[model samples]
Target: MILCFALGIANMFHLHWIILFSVVCLICAFIILFIEIPLLLRVCPTSPAFDGFIRRFETNYMRAAIYFAMSAIQWISIAAKRTSLIAAAVMLLIASLFYALAGVRGQGFVGSKTLGGQGVAQMIV
Candidate 1:
């Protein structure tokens, strides 16, 4: 991932590279949204319930927002105005916070460890 990221960075200096990176990122983002959601639903059978719906909403929302933020990097790099840079920076930060809070660490969205412990493990099984 780091290597690909660095390569993308190196490509940013050229217009073709920028376009290629944009297309690739967009495709990957779409694939993640299309593929991961069903897998998550399968992994979590209660996904259509009220609480499950809320969890899926937060998770997918943050995931999409983070990808959107990531896709803005090229725009940020090419942006000429200070205001644009600041706006991009702010969006990136907010997206990152939500992404972190979207439960990647297996804890609940708010940071309590109630979702993935032995208790929940037994229920999931």
Candidate 2:
């Protein structure tokens, strides 16, 4: 959310550098979501430690992607002179932040070592 708002502020000045930065962030987010997560899962199918890390990793990148997408839409709206869509995009970004935060908090309480004592045994097998 902060990054989106910062990008919006930067957009107001019509900065060329921010455009490149935003594109890089968006591409990185997509790469994490589509490539890294699946590869991690495949490489550590039975490791509880990796499972927890992957879950948190996936959630964080998913939130980042949502933010980047919303920010892009907001930028487009501003360029097209559509004030209404800008407000809509801001609202969606807020909603997504809340939703993603809830998931993070839930994961925090659940603990990452879900398999407990059996985790090592499972990995050994």
TM-score of each candidate structure, all chains considered together: 0.30, 0.31
Superposed on all Cα atoms, model 2 deviates from the true structure by an RMSD in Å of 10.3
lDDT score, residue 44, model 1?
A: 43
The residue-by-residue lDDT of candidate 2 on 1-125, one tens digit each, is: 33434444444443444454444434434433432335435444446664554456445446545555655655565554533345536665675576577676665322233332225446645
The local lDDT score (0 to 100) that residue 12 gets in candidate 1 is 44
Runs of candidate 2 exceeding 4 Å displacement: 1-64, 107-125
List candidate 1 segments past 4 Å from native. Answer: 1-15, 39-93, 101-125
Angstrom error of the Cα, residue 68, model 2: value is: 4.6
Itemize residue pairs with steric clashes in candidate 2: none
lDDT of 1 by residue, 1-125 (tens): 23223344444455443445534444444434433343333354443563443344445456656546564663464544222233334454565565666556555433222433234445556
Model 2 weakest 10-residue run by lDDT: 109-118
Score residue 47 of candidate 2 by CA lDDT. 67
lDDT of each: 0.44, 0.48
Candidate 2 lands at a TM-score of: 0.31
